[model samples]
Target: AQSVTQLDSHVSVSEGTPVLLRCNYSSSYSPSLFWYVQHPNKGLQLLLKYTSAATLVKGINGFEAEFKKSETSFHLTKPSAHMSDAAEYFCVVSGSAGQFYFGTGTSLTVIP
Candidate 1:
């Protein structure tokens, strides 16, 4: 069975500070990983993705994630946080069988 786990339910950061959201996963084979962000009552948007092409994947809004195969982790990071960065982030994993697994989600709060 494949599953995704977001280590933190909520992460609060001051504006201009660095942001980090932890995530881990379990899969039988190499999986496709993605990070998505959703605002209040808004649709989900793709932040980044790891498709076995690169270990370090960069996305919009200065977001990036490193895929650690040995550790089964794909942790999201941002150099600086902005007030608009506040949103719900989800770590998703898709296996070879075409099954998608979504994490519980991590809410990011930007403190001004």
Candidate 2:
């Protein structure tokens, strides 16, 4: 069984400040992880992905995430926040069999 947890259900950050969205996951085997962002009335967009190639992965829009096996975490971060960054983020865990488990979802609010 696989489970994903987004530490904060909602997070607020000021523009130009650092942003951190923590996520923890558990799985029986090595699983693939992904972060997705969804804007208002829009579909989900791939934020970043980890497939065991690298411990740190960078994604579009200045977003990145690091895979930490020891900590069982895949937390997302950005050097600075932008107003456009306000959106809902989702943490996903995928098994080898193509089964996907989604976290509760984190809503990000960027203050200008």
Compose the digit string of candidate 1's lDDT tens values, residues 1-112: 7999999999999999999999999998888999999999999999999978789999999999999999999999999999999999999999787878999999999999
Which sections of candidate 1 miss by over 4 Å?
none
lDDT of each: 0.96, 0.96
How high is the lDDT of residue 84 in model 1? 100
- All candidates' TM-scores? 0.97, 0.97
Candidate 2 local lDDT, residue 24 = 100
